[model samples]
Target: MSRIQANLLLTLIALIWGSAFVAQSHGMQELGPMMFTGLRFLVGALVVLPLAWREWNYLAGRQLALNRDDGLKILGLGMLLTLGAAMQQIGIKYTTVTNAGFLTALYVPLVPVLGWLLLRQLPHWSVWPGALACLVGAFLLSGAQSLEIGLGDSWVIASALPWGLHVLLIGRVADRMAAPFLVACGQFFVCGLLALIWGLLFEPFSGAGIQAAATPILYTGILSVGVAFTAQVVAQRYAHAADAAIVLSSETLFAALFGYWLMGDRLAPAGLAGCALILGSLLVVQLLPLLQPAKTSSEVLPIK
Candidate 1:
């Protein structure tokens, strides 16, 4: 995919993710987090079921369809994603929303380092400066006058490592698998099943616990993870990681905007400053085209 296409994908990913938070917050009002996650992902997977036949056909020519190893690889990816997601969900529950937002943003910077370690690809030097900017932004966005790591902060911060790892894994495997099929299908199949078993073994009464969260549940399952994630996989196929990260990072901005518009949350002065810094850093990374300038906002915003 061209750079233009990549930027557009990231933008769409950010928009979807940002909007989903509204659904998640609303859903959690009535449902338990784990159960909510499970059902929502299952909804997304069901959406992708129609594409499974296409995947089966595609894979049959290049690889085995009903093989143990193939199943294991996808399952492994699912397990890792679930672990990261569970950690993140728990982190958000404990920490202030401010901390969760910026902390999770660390995954963008963390990706380059993880890439270096796993793929033997040296990252750009500019990444370090961008990472530092992101760190300060997190500190500021957390709205803390004094630096004190609460238990919640620790969990959220720690979870970002796994989230970063998940991104790297996706980046590596996006080319190998049927991107939409794997993303949408596996959300329900892999994470859904795992969450279900976890709920049964540990907290079986989840359905009864969160029966009233239908709106959010349906929104997340059908729209956010199901549609947005499939789009992300398709977009990633076209965009570079750095460009993609820049676009998706807009989730923070979207969340803040939506929070203010929909939920009456205010963006403090410092918070806006942090947001600007993060946005600037993200934009700074896109100067790689040199002779050919990347397109403007049209490339960054996808109406679809």
Candidate 2:
């Protein structure tokens, strides 16, 4: 797909995940964080199994086995995914959906920084301004005037590091692996299995609790994990990781809207201005490349 198309797909994923913040908040009302995370991701794994099988068959037709190195990389991705998801899930229980959503966007700035530090990949010049704008916007949208943070907000902030690394890893491996669905399946399974084990060990289990959270589990599992994440893996194949992060930052806006409408969360005037800044930053990031003079092959940096 073209870069524009990939970005559009990322935007859609953002919307799905934004709405999922509400579902996640509701889901934990009856279930422990680990239990809810385990169930939803396991359900997501099942939802994507058929696609993963097709991908496996296609690879077999080409006489290719899954690369050992790639398998290890995917395992690492699963660990990071689990870390990020678990922190966010736990944090949502104590924070409003609006706060969780905006705070989680801390990853937008983190992605480009991680890419540079770990892979020595330098993003386009425009990315810096856009990322700064996104960071400031998220801060304003979160409505925190002081450095002190709540426990839930702190957890969500902590999750940003792993989430940023997850994006970089996906961008690094997605094209080379050429099995986005399979990668999605493997990560989901690993995350689910680990979470389930953790939950069973320390958290109480009740079938009725699962039933009570059924709607949220199904919605997030099917849409957020199954469809949106897989699409992210595919889209990142064509899009730069930094660019994808900025585009996906739109989730903060969507989450605010959904939280206001569904969860009775309200944003102040500053939050509304923050929303406009986010939109402006997104436009600048996406449009700058198209407006710039085309670079020669040697002048272009390979997507990392």
Candidate 3:
């Protein structure tokens, strides 16, 4: 797969996730955040099971070699994902909506920084400007006039670290794993297990509540978790982590768009400016590399 194709896939993942915000909100109406998260990911694991099985069968005759450490990495990814989700959900309870939105988008910048520290891979020069642009856009779009840090806001900020790590981890695992579908399944299952355990411990879960949130659960599980996440794993195999992160961050943009269209939400002048900045950042990230001279072999970082 080419970089463009990989980026397009990432964009699609962003779209799916962006639109699924509605379902997420609806699910919370009948279920605790933890309970909803657990059930949805469990459903996602089930949704991916057949696809993973088919992929396994297809590779049965091939000389496919599995890495000994892939399982460990996949498990780590699931744990990180669960932590990120849990933090965001819990943090939202105590923070302003604007704070939650802007802080969650902090992962846009965190991804490249984590990649540099952990993998020694520095992004292209254009990525910094794009990331900053996205950050400012998110801040403006969030409608926050001042910055404040409460416990909930702190949790949200903390979540960005794991989420950023998750992005780089996906790139590394995708580079090494033979079966993306199976990896995705393992991720979902592990995440589901953790979420379920936490939900059972702290949140009330009932069949009636699950039934009430069934449609939202199904949409998130099937499309957001099953399809979008699998696609992300596959797409990151071809794209650089930084590039993929920039594209995936566009989910915030899509969320704004969907809010305006579906919820009768209106964008103020600042919000409109934020949207433009985000769009400009996307163009910078996507097109600047093409305009610049190609990197020599020594300049390009090899995937581990």
Candidate 4:
């Protein structure tokens, strides 16, 4: 797929995830965070299992071997996914869908920074300004002017770190692996297994609670996890990680809209301004690379 197609796919994923935020919020009403997370992702894993098997068969027919290192990386991604998802799930219980949605987007700026720091993939100069804007926006959105944030918002903010790392890791994995469904399946299964273990050990279990959350679990599991995330793994193969983050961040807008319509979420003026600033910064960050003139091989100077 072309970059444009990849971006469009990411946008669709954003919509699914944004709407899924409402389901997630409702899910916590009936189930503990770990239990809800575990059930949804395990369902997701089952949904993807058939497709992953087909992919494995295709690879086998071609006599291609999956690398051991890539398998390890997939496991690592599962851990990050679990941490990020669990934190966001827990946070959504205390915060409005609007707040949770916007705060979760903290990963947009983080992707480029983490890329630069860990992978030595230098971001455009615009990244610093954009990152600053995102931080200020998060502050305003979180009501930090009162000099404190609620526990939910704090968890949402913390989730961004792992979320950013997850995005970067997916980019790396996509570059190395041709089987997107397999990658998605492995991560979902591992995350589901770990979350289920945690839930069983620490969180109370009730079949009625699961039944109460059945609709949400199925919606998020089938569409959000099964379809959207797998699509992301495929799309990122053709898109840059930073660029994909910006597009995925549009989910914040969708979340706000859905929250307002479905859950009666209304943001204060400060929160509105914060959202605008974040969206503007994302646009600037996304466009800066395209705006800058590309240096020719001769124009490029060696870094000491």
- Point to the candidate with the largest TM-score: 4
Ranking by lDDT: 4, 2, 3, 1
Q: Among all windows of ten consecutive residues in candidate 4, which has the lowest summed lDDT?
A: 295-304
Measured by lDDT, the strongest candidate is 4
**120 in model 4: Cα distance from truth in Å?**
1.6
Off by over 4 Å in 2: 1-13, 127-135, 230-249, 273-304
lDDT (tens digit, per residue) of candidate 4 on 1-304: 9989988888888889889999999988888999899999999999889999998999888987577887898899899999999999999989889989888877867877999999999988888999899888887887666878888999999999999888777756855687767877889988999998999899887899899999999999999888886676677778765567577768889999999999999888988988888888877876666554663111100000
Candidate no. 4 TM-score: 0.87
Q: Model 3, 66-177: lDDT tens per residue?
A: 5567778889988988888778766656554434544566675566667777888877677788788877775665566777436766776788888878766775675566
Which ranges of candidate 3 are over 4 A from the true structure?
A: 1-13, 58-68, 91-105, 149-158, 230-250, 290-304
Which pairs of residues collide in model 2? none
User: Where is model 1 more than 4 Å wrong at Cα?
Assistant: 1-13, 61-66, 95-99, 150-154, 178-180, 204-209, 233-246, 285-304
lDDT score of model 4? Answer: 0.82
Q: Could you give candidate 1's per-residue lDDT for residues 1-304 as a string of tens digits? A: 7879767766877877776666666665655556666777777778778787677777787765546655666777677767766666666556544445556666666767787988887876766788788777766666667886566556666766777776677544544554536544764578877875676566545455566777777777777766776676677667765566467767877766666677666657876777677666655544442213453222212111
Better of 1 and 4 by TM-score: 4
lDDT of 2 by residue, 1-304 (tens): 9989988888888889889999999999899999999989999999899999999999989987688897898899888989999999999998789878877766755666787889898766777888888767766766778755567877887888888898778755666787877887888888898998899899987999999999999999999888886677678778865567467767877888899999999778887777677667765655565554673111111111
> Which regions of candidate 4 fall more than 4 Å away from where they truly are?
1-11, 231-247, 292-304
